[model samples]
Target: MARLNVKPTRMELSNLKDRLALSTRGHKLLKDKQDELMRQFIVMIRKNNLLRDEVEAELIAAMQEFVVAKSLINESFIEELFVGTETNVELNIVEKNIMSVLVPEMNFTTSEAEVSSDVQYGYLNSSSELDEAIDRIETVLPKLLELSEIEKTCQLMADEIEKTRRRVNALEYRMIPQLQETIRYIQMKLEENERSAIVRMMKVKDMGD
Candidate 1:
């Protein structure tokens, strides 16, 4: 590292020493923060993975039921049923902080006054498979929303981890090293000057004797 441009004096050495102390302390704190963020990030990733697997399995099962229902029923009837149905679902988003990262919390609400049952279609014209499919689809709704929440949280945590990693690296590799080198240079220069002054004083005393 390049030596800092400063006078070879005791005051400059003291000042550089102080700066180095502060930099060292700051580095430790930042490293601790990075460690905590990493721990939180790993937990989020695990949750995301589990939620994704469960949601995918549920959706696949629902799709199979839908396919069976389609095979047993008329396509026009299925279309007509949806066309006559009115859906009123509202999504509200709330946020909370985790390790300084903002993550979304979703609340899914359906109008109970308008939508009360899982089966939107009538029983007379639809097969049992259709009803099963409808029930499974309804069961998947909250899980799907939960999956979305976890995935978004994972993304936000990942970003924060990366940012923290950068800062830690900068301090550990670059800033701390530079401060140490500058402090060392200042100390060495001051010592050499002090030695020179002592030698000059001794020679002058010898001449006077």
Candidate 2:
């Protein structure tokens, strides 16, 4: 590695040594952070995969049920029922810190929501299949929301890991090496200057004698 462009002096060497020490310490801390972030990121990825699989299966089943329900009911009536349906669920978004990374937390509030069936059409016109389909959809809604949050967290953590890794590499490969080389050059220059000064003093002493 190339030495940094710095003055060949004791003071410059001292400053470079100080910077190297701080850089080494920072590199160690960032390595630790990268390691921990990787661990958590892997765990989050696994959870995201499982949750996505489960959510996909649930969605498929719910959609199948909905299709069957649609086949039994008139399309216009189904559309009207959907249009008239009222939902009172509220979602709150908050952030939490993990390893210096901010991740999302979603909280749902449905205190005012009715627990009864959401199949708002008249019983005489709506089949039991429609009610069952609506119930299945409702059951999977929370899991779907949870899957979204987990996936986003996984993405955020992965990004942080990448960023940390880049920083660690830069310090280890570039900045630290340059500082060491520059310090060595300065020390060599100082030693050479000392030897030259001693030789000149001896010559002057011999001339006076």
Candidate 3:
């Protein structure tokens, strides 16, 4: 049902034949690329699911610890003791390429707010339990970020796969077949014309004889 705009001529037919060949080759290549990308996307999707679950579990545990820490020690004392010990933290992020796809890498760093607490005002001070909670939160943060990035990358890859699939279908099922049919039609017409011309020439020669 699809219509091509240009009028078909000898030159145009030759060009169509060449284009049909190129499209067939391109279709195969794109099909392979799409398959590879889909495989990678599926693997990343599985990893993302696992990481998401782990992050959720760790976040819950950290929250519970925070509650326990708050109950065990006075808020004012904990605040005073930890405030001055805070240090600045910087995270180093790197990008990784898989099958020519660039994915994000996450790094965790300890910040001043994480290390320093306000516990100087009273006898009660921050304990290892609080540090444990902070550590768990820090550990989960990067994983959560990684999961997010992976999920997004998978989505983008899926979209590309769909687009490639459509192009392949068009070439393999529609455009190439139509071009071949047109070529056959032209060849048959030319053959018929040649046969008719030969028969007429023979009749004229016999009459002259």
Candidate 4:
């Protein structure tokens, strides 16, 4: 590696050595952080995958039931049945840190102006299939929200891991090696100066004798 362009002095050598020590230490710490972030990222990704699959399957089943209910009922009545429906949703968003990366945590409380079920309209007017579909959708809503949180967390963690990897590589491959080379150069220069001083003293003694 190309050594740093610096004066080959003891002070410069001491400075370079200190820098090398810090760089190596920083590299170790960053590498550890990167590894932990990756581990957590993998776990979240797996959870996201599972949650996505479950949510999709549930939604599909709910849609199938809705279609069946639609076939049995009149279109206008279906719309009227759902008219004026209101659901109050309160979502709580917060951040949690994993390996210094901030990811979101989401929770929500939902209350309906109507009852939780379609029983408000009575069973005679509404088909069981419609009720089943609504229940399925309600059950999957929380899972969908959870899936969204995990996906966002995974995205943020991936970004942090990439940044940490770059820093670690820069320190390990570029900064540390350059400092070592510069320190060696300064040490060699100092050794040469010492040997020259010894030679001059010996020559003076011989002349004196």
Candidate 5:
């Protein structure tokens, strides 16, 4: 803890007293902000955990479907079918501001299934299982992206909350109290000097008389 360098003077002391009062008020308001941020951060953390679990489960299911599709269909046939099809996916990243934190936004064009043609290549036939797998993957992509955004946002909020809490503690427990103590000490010293000067002046007047 760094000690504050407060020069002891009447005007300086008055200023410090005012600063102490202001710091005390600021400390209270900061505490309230910290509490509110903590509450929101905790809620987001809980949601992040739940979303992570759900994403993991969905990913596992999607992988299983991919494996089944691969086993049921021939690789070369699938390759030929997709060769002329456009598989280029474009994703747009947007930003959302939450409590001065920027979070990620994911947006994409429609899935291949929604925009695919009815043409077939060689002896390849697009099965319902393949369509199901593609649909499920498409469904999970946006949710996974959302979960990622939420996790990052929660982390940022938690960090900010911790910083605010530290500042509040410093003002409340250290800075404000020290300033008040110094102000009291200065006031007492000033009063004692004033009383001593009055006594000295009275003695001189009595001697002159």
Candidate 6:
């Protein structure tokens, strides 16, 4: 660590001591914040990982079920049944603060959220596989949205954690050390000057005698 460029005097020394104390307090505060942020980040990342795995598995299962349903029916009929259907979904994102990081919390509303007891189309041509496939996809839709929210939150938290870590490091390894070194240097200079002044005073008295 390097000493700050400052005059070696009682006033400067007092000011440096105040600065060093402030820096020490600031360093401790930043370090505590860093630790708390890391804790929050780890919890969110683990939740993201688990939710991602679940969403992936469900999506794959739905896709596989759809492929089987397609193989058992005419592709044109499948397209005609689904292509014109409108699913109105409204998505809203709100920001939540976690460890001083603003992350997104998502909400969604679907227009056709109700389950129909009666089949929309004739059951004569509809295979059970097709019905099951559609149901699987419908069930997984909310989970997909939840996974999106969790992933976004994790991303924001990671960014915040990295920033906090940098600040903590700067205080612990750079600013605090520099302040301490400069304070020590000023103290030494002041002491040496006092000794020199005392020697001059003795020399002057002996000369007068």
Worst 10 residues of 2 by lDDT: 111-120
lDDT of 2 by residue, 129-163 (tens): 77777877787788888988998898899889989
Q: lDDT tens string, model 5, 34-101? A: 88888888898899899899888878887788778778888777676657655445788888776555
lDDT of 1 by residue, 164-209 (tens): 7888787778877877788788778778888999999999999999
TM per prediction: 0.91, 0.90, 0.72, 0.91, 0.77, 0.93
lDDT of 6 by residue, 63-164 (tens): 887888889888888888886566778899999888678889899888753333233666766888788877877777888999888888878877887887
Error of 4 at 7 (Å): 0.9
Tens digits of per-residue lDDT, candidate 4, 1-209, equal: 99999999898888888889999899999999988888888898998898899999999999999999999877777787777466777899999888788899999988864336434565556787898888898888889889989999999999999999999999989999899889988999999999999999999999999
Name the candidate that leads on TM-score: 6
Model 2 error, position 57 (Å): 0.6
- The model with the greater TM-score, 4 or 5, is 4
- Ranking under TM-score, best-scoring first? 6, 4, 1, 2, 5, 3
Give me the displacement of residue 163 in model 4, in angstroms.
0.8
TM-score of model 4 relative to the true fold? Answer: 0.91
How does each model score on lDDT?
Answer: 0.80, 0.87, 0.74, 0.87, 0.77, 0.82
Candidate 5 lDDT (Cα, 0 to 1): 0.77
Candidate 5: segments with Cα more than 4 A from true spot: 1-3, 78-94, 111-129, 205-209
| lDDT (Cα, tens digit) per residue for candidate 3, span 2-59 | 4355554667668878887898889889889888988888887888788888888999
> Judged by TM-score relative to the true structure, which candidate is superior, 3 or 5?
5
Winner on lDDT between 3 and 5 is: 5
